[model samples]
Target: MLAWTALLVAIVVSFRPTVPVIWGDTPPFVESALLTLETGRPTVAGGRDPGYPALLAVTVAFGGDLSTVVRLQQAAWAVLMLALAATAQTATRNAAGLVPIILVALYPGLLLFRHVLTADLLFAVFLNLAAAGLLVANCAGRTARCCAVAAAVLCAAVAACLRSQGMLVPIATVLVGACVARPDTPARVAVIALSVAAALALLAAGSRFGASDSDQSSTVFLPKTLFCNHLNIVLASDAARREIVSAAGDRADATMARLAADFAAEPGRWPVLGFFGDACLFDAALDRDVADDTGNAVGAASAYRSIFLAAVRDRPLAYAGKFVHQMAYGASVAWPPYGLEPAIPVSTDDVPLVSDIITRHGRAAEPIDLQGGPVRIGLLSDLPGISAYLFKALSTAFVIAVLFWAVTAVWRRRPEFSARAGIVVVMWAASIVTAAGAHTLDVWRYLVPAVPMVSLMLSLCAVELAACLRRD
Candidate 1:
């Protein structure tokens, strides 16, 4: 009853981005969906991940309503929150489920990604499901443990397919579960290892099934290309630049030199080094049309990889410093509510927001808009004054809660719950590093995955604290 009420309330309160949110990376996904529907094959293009597009195609095929899609997505997220809440309650064996469910349903920042056309909403759901599955597996009886582990791995595998960074989720799940399991439990270890291997195999199969067959294809996904691009900026010192040029040889030396010059003119621009700069070195590298008809995107990616590897090989310290800064930057402004295009009001005279929801090809991205007007949560957009303060306060509280749980659990020698806490900390840190490593910019949307993890884990900590107090 509480879960259903929360889902309905969340649907009503955070019903912004009702029209399919389309922008920069959205076209490829939309195109992929259309192609999938038309060709009856799970075809991926434009370096976009195929998981979300394929899902979108399949969903639309059944109902043909994008609004229905958003509602279903929100409900799915709500269901995951309910599951997480239930898991946390079971893990602590306490009356602490309601708070986590409420927090998840009411998270102001969650509103940002809920109804979008991106994979983030689904990615986050899968990750939380995996976390919940691990927690359940940790507490399950011997016979049920194996099944729980399998379910967790399946969730992690789906998460990985949705986004590249998700590949780490299965590993994290196994480690978190193992940490919580009884000592000398080799059977548990075997189960987890088998699950991890199965998940990896599934990911490999998904990639092959979704791979683009274009000869000029980079043969690599957009995520990896973006990653290599970020690495290119990290390797932008004069020595590194010269090394890259030398490595590229005459055929590509000029292009590499030009990129170096661009980096040199504004060092901060490449890695998004400073607080603010338009240093999209990564995007620029992606745009360098060095590939001909016979070329694979892999070759271009290889060039960037070579330079990045050489830089790390030659100057380890530089890489470390940049990496740390990038991670810090990523962690700083994780989930600001209104960064992705501040809500523009639709005047009676202006074009409807529904008409504007199409792709660059002018193809119908959302086909149908169920809402009357633009779905703008006015309080978020109009009053940016409190958003930062609220974000900071909540972020600080979450961090402190995580730290408190970690120290207390270690001091108490309580591995069961602490293992889950540790997983949260590690996953959050890992996500920050992944974002820092992959993107040139430090945008808040990039940290969407961390938001729910932090919230759910912190809520679990609160429950554990309650359990501890009760025992005392």
Candidate 2:
């Protein structure tokens, strides 16, 4: 299964440019990588975790090129697919479970991310790894089970170090373990206790690497500015807006409320929710006024956070409804939110540090947009397909698959199938909460992890159905 998946990934990824695909945010990772290479310390200024850069640094250490890194990432994705495939097979003792993983791997939308330079790819990879490993561990011998649990914990910890949402990975593991572990066994209790403690410790350590709420510079600052823009659109009542703003203590000012209103009123100037692109911190003058009151970005963000929390508290049910709606919206996207522009050859000549490192290492920075990049249609050249329609069919099929699995699992009395679905749901929830939790806007990119997660769940469902129909 692993060999076949790897072959499929390689063949599909061959259409990608020979160079490593680079995006706007790609250089900071290279910055961190070069720093790690020179100093033997994993650190960067842009609030990025060391996990990915550390991985890139290892490639540098081995004199491996960025193109190699791209292939490695693709391979990592293949491993994730195989893990889910293995999960399905192990759960039902049937090889038919490989179907869903293959279907996921063949999805055209996901191929875009395979060779892209982003930590999100790896973060998702480690998370699914933990989920599948934990499920498999449920069926393992005592010694192997302990090792598997330990490995899953390590994967969850690495996932945490990769993204801020990584804290959710630990929770998914715990839930998955609890679902599949035998209740009466003292070892199960011991395993749960040890994993919880380990998860808590890793959560503490990993969070220190993520961007802080107080951080008002770099990428972390945008959420505060964006909330006002979204609020102007979501909350129609002036009185309600005032009540939320008033929660900010001395930091709240009439100007801040007015600025938010003003930005929303402007027709073409500011984006409503920044669903396509953020950094819309909308109007500069608006945040400037808000910032002026608090005397600095930090103070302004603190105030904005207060307003954010207050708005949630004021209409908790409304917030929950919005969250669910946004999750559905994000999941329904068939294509990536970004990276579809006509591609130019990727280059780092403008970024001296990254350029120098690439020059020395002989790595090519290539651009990849599905429409015009070096990526060839290869096998997909025949018919231009609508991704939306494809996704609709897949989603409908997935629902049917789940219904089948639920019936079979109940009739056959299989706890493992239910456990598999539980973990998948938890993982999906984690992504939604992580992306939308900041009280900003939601975009398709934030839900990149869902592509594989949904596949894993679908695989379990399909596997369960196959197991039910087969007879000796």
Candidate 3:
């Protein structure tokens, strides 16, 4: 009942009139959906998986505006996520089932994005539902097991259709399920065979469809061209080329150039170094508009690549140094809410009370021109005091502890429960690794799916802790 109430409140709050107008991936998703509805093709300026757009298109076909339908769908999914959380709590025998409900309800990021037409919310919802099903299968083996496994696989496939990263969830689920199932049992074999066949069928279908289309081809979907084509595009760009050339020029003019270059370097390392440098320069350049006199965006991209490559060949160490620097810059946490607030004031004293009001109400705060917009004021930005530090430290510690406990539980026992839990952890970890590798680590929003998993794990840990206490 508490979970239901929390979910209801979340639904109400998510649809509040005063919610801020924040720029999220929702706009792109909406555009994609609209485009698909009109053109019979999935195309957006920024690359995206077609699943959510296609879903939206179906909803529009039934008679509704893109934004309205998508927002309604998002709200519905948010509620579903809450119910799944409750289910996870029951399945894991965790007393803290309400934790997922509360955390999700109160999280500013989740609240802000919950009703937005973006793939993240949809991906999270499907992923969590699949996770809940996997947990159920782990706990009970029979027809329920078969149903749970099938549900998990199907949901995971739906998730993957939205975001390529989601493919990891289904793959991880199948592997974990197989490992936990009794060896040579008919059920186990059936589960394994079904999952493997499903995956292969999806891949083959994707390949066939992809081959038929020329303009709509993505290297990401093709196994053979994936890495090379992606790398080639990055290197061939003018931005990277220019950076390479500029770096090479700097090396040629430097005194004792021969003495400076004493290291044995692989030819391949040069391109990698150039690629990293070009990527950094591209990111920095994007921060501000370049001079109009300098060629168009495409030309500039090509020039940047040339400069980047030249730099790599001339002074390998210096190029390598830039790569390390870029990685560090990319890895470091800049701020909690990326682009949430434009200027990070040393203190929020002078900011109007309207700003405060907007922070609370978010987009719902009336009058688009109001001082307070649905802009998030970070706790780090607002309260620099020890209290803020303590709260953050505790929250971080709790999350970390939950993760550690989950990892230990999975490692210590090869139980069915642990196997299912391990898959969730692995998927979360993979998302993190992918984000980190791509140098796109910005907001906690990216880690939203991990929240339910963490909550579920913590609830399980709490139950175990209570059991131990009772025994003692």
Candidate 4:
């Protein structure tokens, strides 16, 4: 009965919005889908991989507009809720597990996903699919387990195709599966070896999906030099960033000054400093200057990567410290805040792709403003935040307790540790690591994959706490 209620609420919440949030990023997706149809190649939304554009291409084939695509994403959101519901049910071992799932379903903030055109929502869909598949495989008998494992792997691969960082999902699953698979599991070493092989295969296949000639497609921020790599340069202290940008050939001083001023304007973002890289990233004048500086070849992207790598080599300790800080920030901000109402759109007037989007999706294409905003679902928007806080608190104790149980179960050669329990821990850890590695701060959408893990952990821990209190 609880599952049915969650399903009904999810369907209603997912479909409540009409105006898809059109923002600056909408054009590339529209353009890519059109291009994909015309060229028969897996065209990309700007520098993004083919996973999302391929999805848009299918929608285009169905004669659906941007509206159709957002609806499709909404449907996926609904499916995610159902998947989480099942996982939570298993975790809590009772109706208490449904609490988080129901809270997620009613959270008014999630509706905002319906307005954007990013691959993250779908990528998350596949991640949860893989997680649930892992659970099924772990519990299934021999023949069934083989089928489930294959299905999980294929799902993880499709996820990797959608977003580059998603490559970690399959790799994490393989590693964890090897660790927790039955003691007599055959060819355990072979499985661990296959993780590396699978990751390489996914990366190679992802690059061919018509992203861009640019060196930085689908890896966090695109246009390698300007966003993803350049941002890291900005993340450094003033001295470090100065030294890093000094590698910009002829424009070194000017590049350093421009970035310094950009960071100066924000003054508060800290680890979230990627936004400062955008002016240089999207400025046409800067692009022309860069082209002229390097004789108009692929020098700009190469230079960015070279400079970023140098920073890593020179300031390895600094970079490592920053990476750890960001990971902690990632854990806190991982809650999904997309709501049904429209958000304030970020301007993309400087971006060259705006005109192209107009041509592809018609005049209606707008920038993607997916930042957190209000929802039509009343105070329910607060539910996601509340649950997130509770989940984090619960997970700390849960993981520790589970670790003890797992060790004991292994030591005794007992079947006490359920496979479902093992995969949840692994996915939770992998999700946090992958999201942090994306090096993004404007949003934490990359962390969506970890949410199901958090929610399931919440269900399990919350129930356990209640039982303990009653017994005491």
What TM-score does each of the candidates earn? 0.78, 0.75, 0.61, 0.76
Q: Whole-model lDDT for model 3 versus the true structure?
A: 0.48
lDDT of 3 by residue, 316-423 (tens): 554345445433332232112222332222222322332333344232322323254343422222333543343344345445544655666757852544554565
Q: Write the per-residue lDDT of candidate 4 for residues 1-472, one digit (tens) a residue.
A: 8666756765674465544554555666656666677767665645656777778777767777666787788778888888777766654567877876675665443544544566767777787777777776666666555555655666777787887666677788666555444324455444434544665565565533335432223332344433343455445545445544554556767766665565455444434644444444544333333333544435554555554666566666766665676666655544545442334243345234644555555444444433445223334444656644554554464555456446645776334244456676677656566445445544555565566665665565566657668889
Cα lDDT of model 2 by residue, 1-472, tens digit: 6645554664555355545666655777776666667766655535456677778889878977677787888788767766776676776565556666665665554555666676877887887788777767777876567657666777777787777655677666666665555445676667667766876666564444442322234333444543653463335545446744554435457555655555546354422243322323434443444443446666556555655666666667766766665655554542232333233234444345456646564556433333344543223222235444555666666556556656755787667677567666666666557566454334455666666667667667766666667842
Off by over 4 Å in 1: 1-12, 15-18, 37-41, 60-65, 93-97, 178-198, 208-210, 213-239, 247-257, 260-272, 275-296, 329-372, 378-383, 409-412, 430-432, 465-472
- Best-to-worst lDDT order: 1, 2, 4, 3
- On residues 39-84, what C-alpha lDDT tens digit does candidate 1 reach at each position? 7766666666667877878886886655666777778776776676
Candidate 2 local lDDT, residue 377: 24
Clashing pairs counted in every model: 4, 1, 41, 11
Comparing candidate 1 with candidate 4, which one achieves the higher lDDT? 1
List candidate 4 stretches off by more than 4 Å.
Answer: 2-14, 178-248, 269-275, 283-294, 336-379, 382-422, 463-472
Q: Which candidate is the best by lDDT?
A: 1
- Candidate 4: residue 400 Cα off by (Å): 8.7
RMSD score of candidate 2 (Å): 5.6
Model 3 residue 372 distance off true place after TM-score fit, in angstroms: 12
